[model samples]
Target: MESIGTSQIKKAIHHISESVFVGLCRKVGTSQMVAMKRDVVDILEMVEYYVKTSDYYIVMLSGSCREGFRLKESDIDSMFWPNNYRVIWDLSQSHYYNTQRQTLILCDCSDSPPGFTLLYLLSPSINRGILEACIRMKNSCYISSSKYRQKICSLSSSNETEHGPCVSGAYGTLEYDNAHCLSCDFWPPSASSWIERCHSWPQPHIVDDIVNNGCHFVAIGHKLGRHEDHEWRISFSLAEQKLVYAMNHCQFLTYCLLKLFLTEIINNGLDEDDKLLCSYHMKTVVFWVIQQNTLPHWRPLNLLGCFWVCFKLVLKWVYEGVCPNFFIPDNNMFLSKIHGYKQRQLFMRLYGLYEKGLAFLLQIPSIRSYIINVLHNPKVSICTDEHTLISEAEFDETLYNEIHCFDVLYKSDIQTCMRYLHTIEQMIGSPLLTQYQVIMLQILTASLLKDTALILRMETFTCKNKLKYRADKISCHMLKVAAKFGFITDMLFIAMYYFETRRYRDALSITEMIKGKLAQPYLMYESKVDTKMYTEAVGGQSWCTKMRKAVAWDIRLYSGIHYISELVSEQQSALRKKKTILYIPSFILLYMLEVLCYRHVDTMRVQTALDDLQTLVHYDQGQLIDLRHRDISWQILGICQQLTGNHQTALY
Candidate 1:
């Protein structure tokens, strides 16, 4: 056998780079990341809109979700701060705030290390929670970081635990990490040099935007600081998000690749406590490399080359035992951890992998097959076109995940739902929102409309007479408008609303239409639907058009909203959960509704509806409902059994 020439290897590497780009495109969705970024911002705004109505704190979406990467290991990270409190660097800046309603805390960084500060109270605080967490030091009062974190966690769910500076909890499928922080309107004085260093990258406007957005102080302290219990770590999360947004798609993808490499390769088998490096370290490396103008160009063809450069920087930082923070270089990010014998062990592993060069990427499970394919066949043609990279299946899955992320269920009453409806309407009509934001707002409008309509109908009932009123007509119109923007399964809510209002005939007709639409077999249930099946079912038209015409996805029931009279009991536990979001497959919800509808309309067909529902629940064998949601499937079957007077079967 002849030895492979250097040119052939270079050609293989080029194909490998293209393959990596294509793989990432499919993972995050091609051209969909822009919409995802906008959607996350909208979610933050909407969440803050609702939260601020009841509480004084303002919430934010942070971490990789806001940065537009949806890796499996990516948890939902959020930061919240009281709007009436301010952290100021100078006492002169205290004049910027109204002491009557706002409480000011001076950021004392003199004794603390870089990137850390002790918050000294400058004025009396009206909030009892903050006052109780303060500690008197000589003539001054300093807020105890540990006490404040405990108070925040106490206000949250019991399942949450203290994880670094965040209160971490898991709900449904994802883990949520909530950090209590205080906002500083002015940029940190220590990072003033970063503004001058932005000339090479991050244009002047973006720099201004980042500086204006300022930063926050998370509830944590530097281990080496004297006032460790009282010190708070200055967070550049907001500014970092802006920097990430300014990055081109190639740069963003490169950052994501490095993250994947860290999670899937370097820390692959190491115990959670044993892993030395983290995604933040990888991100810091990328920021330094980009701002320093180390890479000539960050493009699809040079993706692997850029990744190589970043990896080498990581190795250098580890070998030298110094990884500087991008904003404040004097603060070594690797100071607390990544030292001693463990540091040498990590360097050895990284160096061994570095010796393998680009081929070391084969250890990553997500893109391993792609790398192997290109290496085996150097002449293989790999299409890098954005349009070609997206398959119908991937598109559907992406849309499904995006749609379901709107699953936050709150305990709202009639007044709250009406207010939410009004806010959504105003947002939808605004000219400032992007097209993607409008689409998300419209989706939210569907749910709010349904909730408000049901609440109105529920109010029109009386003991003397259950007579129809104008509320019924208003509800009908609102539900129809909701159906216009909602998924195909959302149409069931109309049937559900009608059934709840004792309109059996109307409910039956809507269920019949839904049944006909779902019969197409292209309906998505989790990741069960495939491209081949979709193409065979609706191949002639574009996938976008087909999806628009056929949008029968899964069904979700939010607590605090009147969805189904029969399932109210089932939704209580969901309401008690942290996020209060509940999910039910479309097939299960539809069949259960159909059976209940026939119980009042046609007694002869009741048995048939019940039998079909039972088959779906027990005999479908995970075809319609994914394994993760199988519990809800069984519960629906039990409900149908009890409704049909088969109490014994229901108990079984």
Candidate 2:
């Protein structure tokens, strides 16, 4: 078979995007969304009633249902926050006995006669009671194994196991409105500290908002013998719901399309027993892709490109046989499954689909109909004209919304820019640029202004330097405006500016915040033993090491003379062996930062700077370092030795 060409793939993606929008929009119409919300409220009430009688305080909707990306068959995932906390102790005693005829009788808790033999394994009896209460609640809510079997029988013919527990663990499904069903998973209140755990996550301030807003972890079902049948899955469902809810119409449509493809296309091709990938994986891939890229990349016209990117990400994960859990970096969602031959099979299947492109999708009758309907439907129209006045207005709004009030800073009249900036300050709830947004803004401003003084002023504002602030109030206003955005680089620049101005304590505080964010990924990576095993195999080292180095460099640079010992202690952990083949520019920058930092304080230890420069030269074979920096490093080394009264060593 001829492989799909690039143009053909693009065409297919365009059709797929249109069909997905029409199909999902129709399914999730105003009435359907209202019904979903109503169903969720009802489910919450039912759960609240059950938990109200117990120690649990609140029950909230979570997962796809809350995230507003649910399909026709998607389950409603929910968790209840427990008020009382109890510690569990494992009594590793076996819960089995031999039959009278010497036959091995495996006592199973989930069996017809629910065995209490394993009750010995549970401690304090309170946890056991809680689990039992949760099970009873599931049965009472009409989501028990028996209830599920009945529903299956009523709906369709299926020969699958009818006596097993729900895959989601203590989750129950109920018919919401005859046309839709709701599935909810109950969880015990998290014992873990969200503030401590999420300190290092990307965008610490946003994470702070999430934690303050009541996001918590939950104990979820894992493989039966793993971790004593208990594993805490960090639940970011609330945060995710907020993110998806805030997504523009186009981004949401793209997400729906990806989910649809996973369900209708990918799942259909896989064997019933294959659990290599699922819709959750698809959602995670999209979430990370969004975080790594800018908002403009996900525009409506770029819908096809976004979907293609999502598809490629999924394909990459399948091929690698690993998918890191989004919230918990160490938790490999596919750890127990997708290994060796199974992984190869999944890769081949996905690759084959990729190769076949739209031709394979067209072969599916339902999909073909969707495509045809999307193409001809009067209600669904793809606007291709960009020259219209409406289009221009929309374009301007798009730029305004994404670029935020900062767009006004680039106006032809400087006074007008300042006025708009002042207006934005007075306005409540103005959009603030993220770190990535600031970078883009910087580039845009530079490209448009073409004025070096203005650009330097912008940089000085970003740095938040007090030294230049007295010179101009405009620069001070710009600094305040940039501070509102709170970009990561902004903080770094501010810290550096403080350090340069000898405000050591203030610089240390900002550097600590940067350290906290950078350290989060490392802490997450270190928490899971499996992460280290798959680190290199899955391309984690590249990103992980870079983040570690950032933290290391920040500590070494801005930590001040008082905290130098801490930096020295963290050196080995922070600075891993560099990859010989890949030249990381950050490594060089880190060395330079270190050299500059050491020269500013503690001249006696300037030897450390010289050593770092030497290591950098050796690692990249001097290709990255300037000859001037190398000579300066040597001079610094000699000066430090002389200052330490080692004249002979300094001369040598």
Error of 2 at 92 (Å): 29
Off by over 4 Å in 1: 1-11, 31-37, 40-55, 407-411, 429-432, 459-468, 525-548, 576-579
TM-score result, candidate 2:
0.40
RMSD of each predicted structure: 3.0, 27.2
lDDT of 2 by residue, 393-460 (tens): 22222222222212222233344344333433343232543333333334233222222223345345
- Worst lDDT 10-window in candidate 1: 541-550
TM-scores, all models, native as reference = 0.93, 0.40
**Full-model lDDT for every candidate:** 0.81, 0.43
Q: CA shift at 104, candidate 2, in angstroms?
A: 39
Please identify model 2 stretches exceeding 4 Å from their true place.
Answer: 1-19, 30-57, 86-206, 213-230, 269-272, 358-367, 373-652
For model 1, how does the per-residue alpha-carbon lDDT over 411-515 read when each residue is reduced to its tens digit?
366777767666666666767776556666666677778777877766665523434466778889999988876767778889998888788899989999988
lDDT score of model 1?
A: 0.81
